[model samples]
Target: MKHIFAALCLLAAPAAAQNAPHVVTDIAPIHALVTQLMEGVGEPSQIIPTGSSPHSYAMRPSEARALRDADLVVWVGPSLTHWLEEPLDTLSGDAARLTLMDDDRAVKLPMREATELGEEHDHGHDGHDHEGEVDPHGWLAPSNAVLWASVISKTLADVDPANAEIYEVNSKRFAEEVGALEQEITAKLAPYHDASFIVLHDAFHYFEATFGVEADAFIVAGDGSTPGPAQIKALRDHLAEDPATCAFTAPQENDSLLRTVIEGQGTRIAVLDPMGDGTTPYATLIRQFADDMVACFSQE
Candidate 1:
């Protein structure tokens, strides 16, 4: 009788494991969105850890295993996290995957032209060049995020039909919250729409376009690589010529280079994190980003 009982327990373990859906997301912001949708249903796992750039991140063994085990995987696609493409194809080929960048509902924006420094500025010497590509930082735009929420809820509902109602409810709440955030951010940043600023990278173009904020140019390339000397010289000349009031740096990047470039120019240096680190519930991240922009650009 004891042997039979042990056998029964062993047989039921896989069934128990299968009871809950396993969803995995690539980045923090996307994970936050999935978390909001999966509230009261199941927890989603984040593949890309905090403080890591998806542009150049290599997956760990554990993360690869998570991908293979996941029932559903959500990611921004190859444009952002190019490292995940082959792994997803080889390991989790059968698993359901949602590439947000390729989704028709997502509001895709083309990468803006690099600021023309001057006739002497030669872009060919600079290896950093993405003159014509789509920006993958769609989450920074609240409208794109709202669309993502709808798609996520539907995907979750399709996979875990038992929790369809909960996902739907959560998605509706998310949309309403995002709408409110958009209105609030618009009002808060309206005063700084005409203000010129420089970002550490070009990731904020979506955010800028959505909120009417303008960035004169970015200090670094889209891939987070250091700009070549020519690029740096061009940026310095542009700054000296135009004189932006604010220069923003990312949390992961050292601001010394930025300070060196704009020293004695009275440009206030500030930190702007594209990834939502240390903030949960997703909405707080969006709010914090807006607040940070206002704080930096609104400074006299």
Candidate 2:
């Protein structure tokens, strides 16, 4: 009887292990990246709920529970998701975890300027203002996405070695898609290398640098910090010089101030999704961004 009971417990252990779930942070871009890498092996729940900025976000009660139960947790790093740093460290135990910035295995952008609101920022050699504190928007670059997919796949396999084969398959498929997307973006934005525009925030540093596009002015001084009179005046001067026909921003940013600032300058607002929305299969989002850029410059 004792031997039988012990055998039953052993048999149930594997089943319990196999049923474990993954929990990733709520940053949409990271969520999308993880989703691609873990498509077949398993799905990852977001720790930071949608519609909140990751820069200053705090994990909710339910998010903590999810993290506590997670088999794997993936995030950008403390520099990117500053608010979730403490909670993430506390919740993640033996769970396989990967911070894209600190992994060193992945290619990342050079550190740039810091925002008053704690967003990452970077500047390209071309003298154009880039996005985020340390260019944490590495995922914006498709090549970086390839690196991310590889890393995520490997981590997922490490967590559940039995599903290693599945992770490899997903990684390969996703990498091919990203490669194609890179080609598409290169071809699409090739014409706009000289056509400069203005933006609400410096979120497109990586995007612009990757495609050789330039931004002339930023409506918001930093990440979520709004510009003041002097800053707006500076933008007005830039507008006068560059005469940007369009202004760009993430879908989540408020356009009203941008509209007001560029109002008399004759520039129109063009919303860009930094989060890589519905077309967020990595390749698809890049393609969509290409289309948006073309539309922004081509519009009469």
Candidate 3:
């Protein structure tokens, strides 16, 4: 009887696994969106751990296992997490994958040259650097988040048809919440529309563009590559000529370098997390970003 029971348990394992669809997301913000959609249906697994920059992250053995076990995988694409492309192609080839950056509904921003710093800044025109280049921080745009929520819900519904209604309801609720948040943030940031700021990285272009915030320049490009000395000097010169009211740095960047650039400039230094660490709900993440910007720029 014991031998028979053990054999039966082994047979039941695969059946148990099929009870819920396993969805895997690349970063915390994407994971939050997926989790909100799958609230009453099932939970999604996140690959990138907290406090890690998606631009320079290395996947671990456990994350590899999670990728292999996932029924569906969602990510921003190679621009953000290039490290996962090869592994995901090999391991999760059969799994349904959604690259949010590739979706037509997503609003793709071009890679603006660092030298362009004002309201009438020119877009990058060099064809050599423009091909296949786009800002991968689409989640920072609330509209993109809403669009991604719809895509996620549709994908989840396809995999778990039994909970289609729940997914649909969640997606609609998420869109409504995001729309409301966008309005609230727009009003909150109205006073700072003319405020000049410098970001540690070029991740907030979408956010700034969406809300009419003036981000004068970013210290580093979108890929997290350090700027050359020449570029640093140019940034320093720009800051000196038309001083920024605030200089925002990500939690992962070096503060010393930022201080060196903004020294004696009277710019308030603030930390902005594009990844939305410690925030579970997607709405909360968006709100946190808006509030952080307001707090930093509103200071006297």
Candidate 4:
């Protein structure tokens, strides 16, 4: 009887594994983080194809089907991709949702204003009236990434209790890897205490704050205002005063205006890819950031 029961239990293992939840996620970073927890249990599918803007992505038929069939849907929340909110409610209504931005364990920071020459950033509000608005690039911070591992692990375990032990083990490994990666990057960037840079978008503040780096100035005001004559002149003047070693611009940006501003100022331009091409590992993305920033001063 014991031998017969052992054979039955062995046969049930693969059947149980086949019933794992079909988890779907948004963006590459979130997908990558969740991927770590699902190792040996199940793979998570990403809705956004990557290298695509989170703010504006037309869902493909496959992605739509994935959302519709998902057992769980994970995203950073509407702050980053408000467009996804409606789809989540209508299309993936039956799927369990995990919005990391609302998690209390994760650290949240307010949006910041473009700093002028000789102007100090207030860090919290920076004189901007953004009271309740929080920056959506929370994944850039390693600490938040660590918290997300646990959160994702717990959610997956809840949905697939049969794979709970696998999720727990993988999540712990993910946390340790991130902790070590942060320490190495922190020390690597420690020598850049006095270096400065320009950002096309105000997306890197979370990463900056985590590594003790700060942007010297920002071109766009984020209110949909174009860089006018006075704004251009202000940037020119700031460049003369606080010449940045590098200008960290986002992908798909037309940098001609920016190129004109720092033309003769000797600022090398670098691209900051927040969402990778759906293939970059989470650790690789973080390391690339530190490498780019360090290259800014090192190349000089």
Q: Give the Å shift of residue 194 in candidate 3.
A: 0.7
| Model 2 lDDT at residue 144 | 76
lDDT of 4 by residue, 1-300 (tens): 999999898887765356779999998889888877887766789988766767678999899889999889989998888888988888889889999988888889876654432353322222345546788889999899889889888988888888888999998898888899999999998999778788776778788889898888776543223455666676777678778888887674667777877888988998877666555777888998789778767883
lDDT measured at residue 76 in model 3 versus the true structure, 0 to 100: 92
In model 3, pairs of residues that clash are: none
lDDT of 3 by residue, 164-262 (tens): 888999999999999999999999998888888888778888999999985787766776666666667767776787888888987767788788889
lDDT of 3: 0.82
RMSD of each: 4.3, 6.9, 4.5, 5.5
Error of 1 at 107 (Å): 1.3
TM-score of each predicted structure versus truth: 0.89, 0.83, 0.89, 0.86
Candidate 2 displacement at residue 236 in angstroms: 1.1
TM-score of 4: 0.86
Top lDDT model: 3
The local distance difference test score of each candidate is 0.80, 0.69, 0.82, 0.79
lDDT (10s digit) by residue, model 2, range 12-128: 665424553565655777787777766655567776555666667766788888888777778877766777767766877766777887766555655443232122222222333
Model 1 CA deviation exceeding 4 Å by range: 1-18, 116-125, 128-131
Name the lDDT of candidate 4.
0.79
